[model samples]
Target: MRYSKFLLPTSKEAPSDADSTSMKYMYRAGMIRKVSAGLFYYLPYFNMILRKVNFRIRRGMEKLNSNEMKFPILVSQEILESSNRWNAFNKEMFKLKDRNDNGYAISPTNEEYATLVSNLFVKSYNDLPFSIYQIQQKHRDEIRPRNGVVRAREFTMKDAYSFHADEKDLHDYYKLMGEEYTKIFADLGIKTFPVLADSGAMGGNMCHEYMAISPEGEAEIGFCDACGYAANLEKVECKDIYSIDGTYKNKYDKIETPDAKTIAELMNMLQMEAKQFVKSMVYNADGNLVMVLVRGDRNVNEVKLANFLKATNLELATEKEIKSIGSVMGFVGPIGDLQNVRIIGDFEIKGMKNFVVGANEKNMHLRDVDACDIKCEWADMRFADENDVCPKCGAPLHVSQGNELGHIFALGKRYTEVMDSVFVGNDGKNHVPFMGCYGIGLERTVASIIDQHHDEKGLVLPMSVAPFKVDIIIVDTKKENQVKTAEELYNALEDAGVPVLLDDRSERAGVKFNDFELIGVPIRVTCGRSIENGKLEIVRRDNGETVEVEIANAKDFIINMIKNY
Candidate 1:
């Protein structure tokens, strides 16, 4: 490719709207242009990255015997209603009406469509374990899509689905897809770890997300340092080390606490540590008053709380709701024989003894309270933090934040059963097929690759994904010898089956050098005064290593250097 003719619009200044390091560098490298909030124009260089990523994903799927196919982005609402997901996914789903006034949706995913496809083609158990995939655009109506391509409204996805006649087959395929996802990430040169994921209302390792660790990411993960147990923040569990089985010095007793409504105030007044107090929080779980208790030092992770209680909505209880429960706001406790309203306790609560709790009144507390004396169900309902003991091996966990690049899930019979799509079994009866889903966000994956592989200058793309393998720079385009040598080298590299970019523009040497680095071609060759000496200067982009090679051996050396790319 000739740099002068190509649409490589390199810029000196980064865009103000970029929300991450990758986003800024991507703009400066001319891989993308911002069209609107949450929308972008992926330039030719960006398309090159997408093509490579898509090729790798397709290769992975084919190895697992999955057939590639395409689905319409705009889906009829009838399909969603058939799958019983219309109402459930109404919010965050983009709805529309066509000319005939029929409701439709810009598909966020292809779950229902895949089921519909099976409804037509899969007629017998002989077609069991069917796997199909597609690389296309997906949409979401984001209230606020931040983090550049990391949270875009319309982006590319490589989504795959599998149908099995039995649970074992589905489970097996799920594992296979997980392995394939790991391989895909490896091939892409991105580091990833799979963590436990929520597979809807059902739970288990049947669902997992391949997360790319990055400091600029948005998701949090907790991992065991000893047993390799890792999980997302919403589902991670720490050992119950704070629960007290021994008795306390004093039994439950009323104590005066003036203006000590908060935990910090009470801790200061009683000269006690945060672990000595039970932090009781009031919440409205699906419009019903409920109390969630955790240690004062811990926080209630609402995602876990709602999932545990099977609540559709979980938010802090209004003052009116708290008052109606015969409890003071900020003073509600699991004790005091409080009735009607349900109380839920964290796993840590079981180990707490002789702890302080609210007395169901203002400016008062119940001291020396044992959780056993309180009526509540205990479960893991708090965020696992740093230094928390690992539930698997009792080692301190290492918790960090990251970005998810891929996810594979076992859908069980959720869609197949709901849509009443079934196949004739060997038993001569119609039975629903178990389903599994796998997805990779192409835009996010590209951005994460940039995040994982860039430096202060610009993108340091992996050799396999770099737009071109070699860059030929005419240090002085005004010099005829430099131009002829650069063109000859470019033609020679092309003849050797290597992609090379020739900087044929009449620009300054410094400008050409900066642009080549920003674009990040893996190898660069300068045909300057070196050509007069029967030599060529080769530069490795990753390490800036320079070597002088005889002009006759330049093509073979460059080919060998980028052969593994």
Candidate 2:
């Protein structure tokens, strides 16, 4: 492509609204433009890169015998309601109505339709293992989408679903897809690690998210260095490392706390460490009020709590609910005259003796409270932190931020059973087929590449996904020798099937060079005064290594270098 004819707009300054590095560089490089919050106009350059990512993902799916297909972007409300997901995704789904007043939603995913397809085609155990996939746009109404395309409302995703006859087949296929995902991300030039994830709203017992470690990521990961145990913060286990001391140090008595409503204020008044206090948190789990107890220094892992109670909706109890329970907000306790509510305590509380707790009355606290005084069931309900040891190996944990690029789930008949997608087994009995889901975000993958592989200069894009492999610059468009050499080289490279960009515009050399770097082509060939010497200046964008090659050997040399990628 000739620079003068192409709509390649390059800028030196990042947009003011750009928050993340990928957003900044992508905007400045003219690859994308913001249309609104969480929405963007993916320019031609961005589309090219997305297509390359799709190519890699398709190749990987093809290896697994997963046929590529397309599904309707708009799914009917009846189909979603059949799977009991219409209400689960009401907040995030974009709902609309047709002329007849029937409701439809832009699909956030296609599991319902994929399973329907399976039911239509697969009838017996002979067709037990079936897989299909699609590359299409998925929509979600994100409340606060940030990080550019990394968290956009509308983005391209490669989602695949596989149906099998039994649990064993589903398990085997799930493992294969996980392995294939590793290869796919590796081919895209992004390093990712799989972590145990909570299958929220997907209705699955087993799932894993492929996370790319980045500071700008929204997901938090807790991992162990000793035994290679890793999981998402919501799913990581916090082992019960405490044991009963069997010593009561102080007498249990009530004290006038006098308006100390918070842990910090109580600590300041009582002059006690955070670990010596028991925090009582009230939550309404699926409309049933419950009290949870954890140490003051810890936080409740609501995901874990919800999984334990098997509740669909869990949130902090409202002030009215707390008042109805006869407990003041921030002063609720498990030991008080609580009625008709389940009390659950963290496992660590069993070993804590003479700890402090609220009196269930305003401006009052119970001092020297022991485990024997509290009535509750013990469970692991605290979030894992650096201070917590890995449940697999007793080693200190490390927590870091990560972005989810892909996820694979062993759905285990979650949709097939509900949708009545059944197949006749060899025993002549109808059975629900076990299902598996795998997905990768195309735009998010590109954003992660930019986040992981960029420098102060501009993007340091990987050769496999770069839109153009070589950028040919005409330092002086007026110079006959320079323009002639640049055009010849550009044609030669293009004829050789190498994507090349020729900067033949009437612009300064520095401006052309800067734009070339910003676009992040792997190789740059400059046709300047050096052409008079029967040579051209070649620069490698990755390392800034410059070499002069004879005009006769330049095309072959550039093609050979790209082959090494």
Candidate 3:
């Protein structure tokens, strides 16, 4: 394809609205254009790259015996209601009304649709362990869509669902899917770590997320370099706690700490480390008043708290609710006038012999209150930090940010049982099928690839997903010899089964070079004065390496270099 014939409108400056490096470069390289806050239009160049990547993913799926299928982008509300996702999804789901006034939703995921299809088609045990996949558009009403395509409201995704008979079959397919994910990421030339993740709202016991490390990522992962233990912070466990000496001479005393509410203010007045103080918060879990206690320095992991209480509904209690419970806003404690609120404390706080706590009255705080003096159920209810010890191993944890590209989950019988999707087992009994879901955010993968593979100039596309494998540039387009040589090389590369782009416009050498660099063609061949010498200059985008080869050997050299690179 000639550069002029294609919509390769390379720009030198990034759009003002582009927030991330990937978004900026994609806009500048003419890959995509923003239509709204979280919506974007994939231009021709972006579409071409997407097609190539999709083809590669499809090829990998075929090797795993996964059949490809297409499902509707919009699903009826009845389907989601039957699956119990209507209430489970809450506000994150985009719901609309059809012409007939029936409710419909843009699917955020396809687990329900896939399970419905399986129930209608698969009747016997012979169709038990089949996997189906599709690359289609998905929509979610994200609370805050930032970091370019990494957190978008509408994006393309490749979702695969596998149905199985038992735990053994599900585990086997899960392992196979993991291997396929490793291969796919390797083929895309990106380094990713498969880390354990919490199955949020998916109603599963086990899940894994493929995270690509980046400084701008939003998800926090706890990794232990020594023990090789990695997990998402939501599910990471810590076992270390601050030890309190029994011989310490600090005595329990009530002091006036008027209007000093937050931990920082209390710490300043007392001139002590945050570990020396205790923090308490109030929450409403399933319409029941609950109090949570933790160390002042630690943050509460709400997800873990919700799971601990086994409550589907939980939210931070409002100030008005706290006041109505006969407790001051800043002064709350476990020991007070008897109330019907449940008190849950962190295990670290319980282990402390003498800890500081609120006095439950205005202008007063209780210091050196021991855990044995208070009554509450305690557990590891706080967020894991760098100072915490790994639950699996004794090594210290390290925190890093990452963007989640793919997630594999063992859904167990959550959706199947709710939707009444059953299959006949070998015993001739009808049982709910164990389900697993695997998902890849196609646009986010593209964005992550750009995030991991770019420099100050622009995108450094991988050869497998580059819009064109080779870009043939006539450095002096007006020169007859250069033009003829460039055209001949372009045709030769195309005839040799290479995707080639010919830059045949009458542009300056610097402009052409910058355009080629911005567009990120993996390889470039320049025909200039070297044409008269029967030599061509080949430039590699990954590393600024250039080599001179004879015109007769340029095609083979370029092909071999691309394959090796």
* Candidate number of the best lDDT: 2
Clashes of 2: 0
lDDT tens digits, residue span 1-565, model 2: 8889887777999888898888999998889999999999998889999999999999999999998999999999999999988878738899999999999999999999999999999999999799999999999999898999999999999999999999999999999999989888888789999999999888887999999999989999999889988899989887776765555444688889988988999999999999999999999998899999999999898888999999878879999898888888878887778776899999889888888898889888898898767768889998888777887888899999999999999999899999999899999998899999999999989988898888888888899899899999999888998988888989988998999988888999999999888888899999888888999999999999999999999999899989985
Q: Name the 10 consecutive residues with the lowest summed lDDT in model 1.
A: 197-206
Q: How far is candidate 3 from the true structure (C-alpha RMSD, Å)?
A: 2.5
lDDT of 1 by residue, 1-565 (tens): 9998889899999878888888888899998898887888999999998899999999999998888999998988898777666655536789999999999998888998888887888999999889899999988878788888889888999999899999999998888899888888887889999998665533223789999999988899989868999888777775555564654344678999988888888889999999999988998886788888999888998878877787765778888888888889878787765756888899888877788999999878999898667777877878988867777878888888899999888888878887888899999998989998899999888888898887777778898788798889999988998888888888988887888899999898889889888988889899889899999999988988899999999999998888754
Worst 10 residues of 2 by lDDT: 242-251
Cα error of candidate 2 at position 547, Å: 0.9
| Model 1 CA deviation exceeding 4 Å by range | 98-102, 201-205, 239-273, 336-340, 353-369
- The per-model lDDT (C-alpha) reads 0.85, 0.90, 0.84
Error of 3 at 155 (Å): 1.0
Question: TM-score for every candidate vs. truth?
Answer: 0.90, 0.96, 0.94
Error of 3 at 501 (Å): 1.9
By lDDT, the better pick of 2 and 3 is 2
Cα lDDT of candidate 2 equals 0.90
Model 3 residue runs over 4 Å out of place are 240-251
